[model samples]
Target: MTTASSTSSESSQERYQHALMNTFGAPKLILTRGQGARVWDEDGKEYVDLLGGIAVNALGHGHPALVKAVAEQLSTLGHISNFFASGPQIQLAEKLISLLQPASGVGSRPAKVFFTNSGTEANEAAFKLTRRTGRTHLVAMKSSFHGRTMGALALTSKEAYRAPFEPLPGDVTFVEYGDAAALAAAVTDETAAIVVEPLQGEAGVVVPPADFLAKARAIADEHGALLWLDEVQTGMGRTGAWFAHTASGATPDIVTLAKGLGGGFPIGACIGLGDAADLLQRGNHGSTFAGNPPACAAALAVIATIETEGLLERATMVGEKLRDGLAADPRVTAVTGEGLLIGVVTTVDTAKIAAAALAQGFIVNNATPDRIRLAPPLVLTDEDVAAFLAAWPTILDAAEALA
Candidate 1:
């Protein structure tokens, strides 16, 4: 019978290990509350949240707009079955389609959306939609991470994640990421879809060559296969644009979205454009809680806030400052990604760097042994950025010492 007022980090950790599954390992900080880009732990230690819940908190924690929207929606009409419809749900679907419209000033394609509770579910729906083409083969990129669900796991390329679950949904080919030649070779007329992430977030914010996505689009068109872009971590202004693939000028047939779409309220979408829009017939798929009113309302608020606050431009400006400052350090070898989704390749072990950052009241992620990722909220202030940059050298120094 633990009460919130009496709980501490130590007690929470002990209780967590006993009650919860070990999928995520031990908790990092046992955070209690957050606002803007900062959070506090059970013990009241403050930290600047640079990870932004792994790029899901687009408007930051406890944003007034998001809070009000979710609360009001839940009070009015909360969870509803797929058999019924809600205004927020319809509006959100239309809004997502509008956001995906091309920025080239050309006419937009016809698109349809299927909402889900998470990115993996969106991908799973897309996987089923691809199967509707009568071709079973899918071409995916190496180092890609779709999700942990069975269907999405089959599409993901990491062997370690797929080893235990052998005999996955078959006919997926993996190619070296960013290699247009390999992509061309892998996709054939029998291919149902060619799926890729605009920016490989789990692979430390890896960005393909500027022409790579366009090449994939052309290749998919050549074979008459659907081109799918998994923008789970890169959409909703995470990379300064509504969607990261927009910069490549490639219009994908199927686009899966999540992570930031609900501003931490758990919503995902699978969008099919043009002829692919009607692939999922009425009886093809369904989810009970997907696109519930509260989630949709929260997502709408996030989008509205992003537009009204000029957070897209802010993401770009703040991201440039962080990248430039991080790259100036001698310990850092490279800085990649656009906008707030950034990766820093450093000379020291990234795990140590992450630990050092935590000790210094900043939260970052060790995306790989050598790469540290930063996906701070679009609302991150100049003061927070300045604080992190001022502590950058010392964080690196501590990491180097540990190494």
Candidate 2:
């Protein structure tokens, strides 16, 4: 007789293969459960989670606050659609507004927000919001990744991601990332918006110069183009702050967020601060699951946890340790990022290093051939950091020797 667990396990693989299309290839491992930065595969292999669901699991899996909020909200009020708003929806917006402070100037004004189900949807909303300005021209950075949607894909610069689905929304210009002068030249009065990721996450966490954002702001202002900051990966306390653009002292007209916003639950916000807020109106846009109760509740829980637990400060402290320790290893030559969001450059093959680390019971990711990204849960413990650091050398040795 087939045991229930055995039957369920085998059925999971068979059903997934039979029903699901080949997109991301086959699953790495059939993950059964997870908690607090650790996950057990279907085979019951325990692995320390260092990737944190590609930086989306800010609090890790099965976090009590996240679980409780989601469960309670779902039990109470699940999906009300876009016709009416819920308390969690309003409260979460107000909370985000408070987090994303408004700018003061002659035309400067408080920001407004739009909610969506994922990072790509958030970008899609922002993409449409940019059009409300009447100008259709936009300047995006080369190597930028906005989203997978048609509108967002147009703004994205990768030929590989865009070529198969051309010709994308037209009137968008691609500028060299991190080049202040190039950005200045690309953005003009006719341009509706200038979109940038303060730290390019999908491009391997590439941080621009200190003044790059400032320069973008200046150029955008000079041409009357809105400065749109896509903080999907860099915001929500990932870089030791609420927003990566905070260092520039230049407030963006638009900011889009997701990934870690709901601590694993799907939620995204497109904040239109000041005049940018006025751009999108009642008839302009909408989403059914945009700001629903359960999603908002999950997001509120995440923000509340981050604040109450002092995870922001903790992220800064522990991030420095992880970055510095990894840098000490000869294979890891450089480390870039602040707080828990880190990118490591290795002299060794990143894929081999990632596989070796996984074999050694750690979970990190090879963002590229030479870069590994670490966005462990903000709740990642100090002990995990120490354990991973200790295993770093052996992981590298195994990968190198095997190669």
Per-prediction tally of clashes:
0, 3
Which candidate ranks first by TM-score, i.e. highest?
1
Candidate 2 colliding pairs = 109-274, 110-274, 111-273
lDDT of 1 by residue, 209-269 (tens): 9999999989999999999999999999988999998888898899999999999999999
What's the C-alpha lDDT at position 119 in model 1?
99
TM-score result, candidate 2: 0.95
Worst 10 residues of 1 by lDDT: 100-109
How accurate locally, in lDDT, is each candidate?
Answer: 0.93, 0.88
Give the Å shift of residue 244 in candidate 1: 0.6
The digit string of per-residue lDDT tens for model 2 on 329-354 reads 87787899888889999999998988
Which candidate has the top score in lDDT? 1
C-alpha TM-scores of all predictions: 0.97, 0.95
